[model samples]
Target chain A: MTGQVRTVDGRVAGRRGQETRQKLLDCLREMLSTSPYRDVKVIDVARMAGTSPATFYQYFPDVEGAVLEIAEEMAKDSDTLKELVAGKSWAGKSGPTTSEELVDGFLAFWRKNDAILRVVTLGAAEGDKRFFKIRMTVLNSVAKPLAEAVKELQAKGQADKSLDPNAVSGALVSLLASAAEHQKAFTSWGVKVKDLKPNLAPLVYLGVTGKKAPK
Target chain B: MTGQVRTVDGRVAGRRGQETRQKLLDCLREMLSTSPYRDVKVIDVARMAGTSPATFYQYFPDVEGAVLEIAEEMAKDSDTLKELVAGKSWAGKSGPTTSEELVDGFLAFWRKNDAILRVVTLGAAEGDKRFFKIRMTVLNSVAKPLAEAVKELQAKGQADKSLDPNAVSGALVSLLASAAEHQKAFTSWGVKVKDLKPNLAPLVYLGVTGKKAPK
Candidate 1:
């Protein structure tokens, strides 16, 4: 279980203090989604939350700190993504279906948390270790298990033996992450929004099983 | 032709003026590489460029404007990426060679311009149309021709007919982009830096040709 929620000044938050803290986080989340990260400020977040900047600072050190908190929460929720691959069958017709569900599940998780995820991605790309670790947690939620699946199939001679399961699964997950992040790019390329899943799922199936999805 | 280089105030930049503008941009580029985009300021860029904020404004309306300029320059440079796939042979053993070269070329371009591309990606993800368009120009530089190659292979019965050429190529390019952006992530996954190309090239080959890369 998570330890007690504490203010930056080291005071434990009571129920009322916790509600205020959550409200500040929710408001900061909205601010991030609507405005550029560079433009998001503590005063603005405090204003939106109907609290003082002093109160905002009491609970969090800064905007980036609060965003990391939000990212950490989302990373925790990302644990559910494990089910999209864990103990799942990748046999026969089940393979393509598994890929589709994984794609759907992953994309949905990304879309839901895109605002904070964007900041985390930017932070990680900028070489912030905390954000990088959080990103890994989310990606590995699916990737680690998916890589295991690839290894299992390869062991059984159901997949290509030459491929590195970690690389294949990592590439597949990276592909999914990129596709989810830039879905609009596909639209401009003449692929429909609905066409994405149908196309991506097969590629995932192919990448994992090293065979074209059965028609 | 790129037409006349002009200042934000609508004055044409002469040779000397262009040099100053370029210096400012170069300095801003350095600032972006070393600092967080959110924390990068016009004043800091101006200071680093040994110029006044007013002079910096003479060349660019703002930091984002200058960044867009840098991204535009990189987009123009992206034309070279087309050669990686434009007229390359993807037949038999040549298929894997083409894939490896494409991976190498694309990754090199990304690594060289990772700083600017990071801002562009963040801007695009945040729904900025200008940044999105530039990112597209860079990506489409490869995705378009790669798709055409896939189409040709599909037509010749060398690739899976059921898969969409555009989708397959787009996904592959997306994978490369993601992989390039997060090469560090792959390294952390027990994948060595040297292992990326050998691993990714085959995935590209597999995705495009619908078969494992021939040993």
Candidate 2:
């Protein structure tokens, strides 16, 4: 479990202080969704939170610092992704259903936190170690479990044994991430938002089961 | 073919004018690689190019405009990605080879112009129409041809006819773009840089042909 939330000055936040901190984070999240990360200012976040900039500074050092806090929280929530692949069947009709549900759940999770995830992605891509670590945490939540499933299938002669399970799982998860991030791009390619899951689910099913999904 | 280079004011750029414009773009590209996109300034780019800010303004309206110019140029270069998939064999052993070469060649193209592409990715993800259009042009350079190949295979009964060729091709191309952009993520997964192509190629082969690669 995460330790008690602490201010930048190393003080443990009380119940009221935690509320104030949470409010600041909420406002920062909103700012991220409405404006480019570069334009998100501490003063704006403070104003939106109805708190002084000094109060904002007390909880977080800067916008990037606060963004990290938000990303870390999101990473914690990513634990739910584990259930999507864990204890799932990849045989016959169940395989396609598992894939469809996985695609649905993953895309929903991404859509829910896309604004912060976008910043985290950008930061990680820029070689920022902290952001990269956070991204890996989120990715591994699903990737590690999915890799296990691939390994299990490969061992049982249900999937391609020559392929590396980790690589396949990694590619599948990366594909999901890309699809979720650029859903609009898919629209431009003539794929409807509603049609996305059906299309992507089969690819996931194919990648994991190493066969065409059952009708 | 592209028409003659012109300044922002619609005047035809002479040899000297084109040199200044090119220098500014080079400097801008360098700046993007070294610093955060949010921090890249027109003044900094101009100074680095050994020109005045006024000279920078003559070529581009602002930093975003200059970034778009660089992105547009890179998209043109992306035409080369088409050759990687177009007219390529995907039969038996040749299928895996085609996948391998596509993976190798696409990753190289991304690595070569990563700085500009990074900005374009950010811009597109943020819903900037110009950036999104340019990103599509680059992706379509490969995705279009790749889709055609998939359609051919499906028609020949080599691929899954039930699946949408465009969807499969889009997903595969998205996987390639995501892999190229986050090479380090693969490294952290205990997959070595050299191991990436080998792992990715097979998946591409599987996705495209819906069959295991030949030995």
Q: How do the predictions measure up, each by TM-score? A: 0.98, 0.94
DockQ scores of the candidates: 0.87, 0.75
Model 1 / residue A22 / CA error / Å = 0.9
Candidate 1: list runs displaced more than 4 Å: none
- List, residue by residue over A1-215, the lDDT tens digit for candidate 2: 66888988999999999999999999999999998887889999999999899999999888898999899989999999999999999887788889999999999999999999999999999999999999999999999999999999988988888778888889899999999999888888887888889889988988888777777
Instruction: Give a tens-digit lDDT track for model 2, residues B76-142.
Output: 8998889999999999778888899999999999999988888899889988899999999999998
Task: Show model 2 residue runs off by greater than 4 Å.
Answer: A10-16, B1-15
Clash pairs for candidate 2: none
lDDT tens readout by residue for model 1, A1-215? 78999999898999999999999999999999999998998999999999999999999988889999999999999999999999998999898899999999999999999889999999999999999999999999999999999999999999998879999999999999999998999998999988999989988998999888886
Q: Model 2 lDDT vs. the true structure?
A: 0.90
True contacts kept of each: 0.89, 0.72
